[model samples]
Target: MNASMGPTLQTQGFYDRSTGTVSYVVWDAATRAAAVIDPVLDFDSKSGHTATRSADGLLAFLHGKELRLAWILETHAHADHLSAARTLQERAGGRIAIGENIRQVQTTFKTLYNLGREFLPDGRQFDHLFADGESFILGDLEATAMLVPGHTPADMAYRIGDAVFVGDTLFMPDVGTARADFPGGDARTLYRSIRRLLDLPGATRMFVCHDYPPQGREPCWETTVREQRERNVHVHDGITEDAFVAMRTARDASLEAPSLILPSLQVNIRGGQLPEREANGVAYLRIPLNALRTVGSMPARHGSA
Candidate 1:
């Protein structure tokens, strides 16, 4: 239970195959108002086909509950998922928001993706660009965006009541925190960021963005600071900064690229909206042939060791 909390916050997770990204819908039980976080827009890499199967599921859930959606919140521009937030905003009639630092990420990737000069990195794509420590409303629930960058320059954790929707910062205690090897990612910085999250109240329920199934357990996304501190292999209570960095660097060095890294970054940096249609008015995403040779090569790992 939350400390002096009022209406309970309900959360559900949905996974998309295109990038193995997990999307969530969180709501207030009393007012029947809700917010979707990191919702997925389905894409088929082989056929170049994109759809809304996952987003449709979220719409179905909202419809079934008769909840009024107030906003679509993204923790950051994901590098392994295509957010269906805009699509949901259109259907659910709510504003979409993300961290203000997203503009930096957008600028970095727009050049990488070779988007035309007309593409702006001013964060106009999102309804609102929240600054660190910014707070907003969702019916009876009060949510604040805390800047916890490491996995990416714009990554954030949403403190909704007693639960923090920590995008990809810290995972379930048994699993540990997200890797910091992507563009603009740093293991040392991630060490500091994870500490910030751990500094929260021990009882705070941490909701994760994605969960890779462990040895034999089903995928899950909820944990707590205490549990993580005591059991998380990477950053438990007494872990030192130097120890964490060495482990993180060695581990990150052995991991493979996210299956959808190439596509995820390009779409995510644009705030989930796909590229504009061509003269034929048909939208397309580019795959730079062999561009990931060395500059973009992913380290190969032996699973989650």
Candidate 2:
């Protein structure tokens, strides 16, 4: 997709049709310093093959414009696709950052997946952990990390200049919001976080992490705060918090698990590090037998991995 020019930030979105994810590369055009958000490492769950095509695509875009990479930020530990943060960091030389609350996410999944005690949920895996309302520099553009937990305890939204990259907290007005049934997810919290985003100036542009386009429409990832407030079916004007939570909770119960949840979390928890190699230098993935219950089978239990 062509880049959109914000007041001070240049933004572009890449669509991964395989997982319905939209990764972004944002930079200060004047300084050419850039950061990427929620990059994907292409993983074929059926065959267990991982590829760097998606990350490489982002690199090509930055290199094409001679942008200096500064940060690879994860909005959260995703459940739909493996993070390409480590791969991007190695090639682009940028710090990897996520919300400090990622420790809680790591801990929740650690026990569920039976990870060893060697794995500490201390938020040390990433190069930096951002606190709520934290401010930083991405070239000349001022960036702030806003804690927007609901889809996951670690979820964060990055506000740069007049644009905000909101991961999984929202979708196009017609598609409504993301599901909040993941461990540590709460519909009530998500509603408030969304209100905060909507309260921004009407012209504030918003970007989303994924887009599930309904039939007969093309995928979209950019919308203005005003557009959402006026049209977002799930949380638009007059939608009470009680109404949102009730609607969101009921909807989530009927949804099936994300196709990549198991594989994604294992790599995501370690900052996108694959499992350690065994004596034979082969890293194997574990598949628990009937350990997970699908939606409507039983209430999903939360745990520490």
For model 2, the stretches where C-alpha displacement exceeds 4 angstroms are: 293-305
**Residue-pair clashes per candidate:** 3, 5
Local error of candidate 2 at 86, Å? 0.4
* Clash-forming residue pairs, model 2: 109-305, 110-305, 111-304, 111-305, 112-305
Q: Which stretches of candidate 1 lie over 4 Å from their true place?
A: 1-6, 16-20, 290-305
lDDT of each: 0.78, 0.87
Worst 10 residues of 2 by lDDT: 296-305
lDDT of 1 at 251: 83
Residue 152 error, candidate 2, Å: 0.9
* Residue 169 lDDT (model 1): 82
Question: 230-252, model 2: which lDDT tens digit per residue?
Answer: 99989999999999999987887
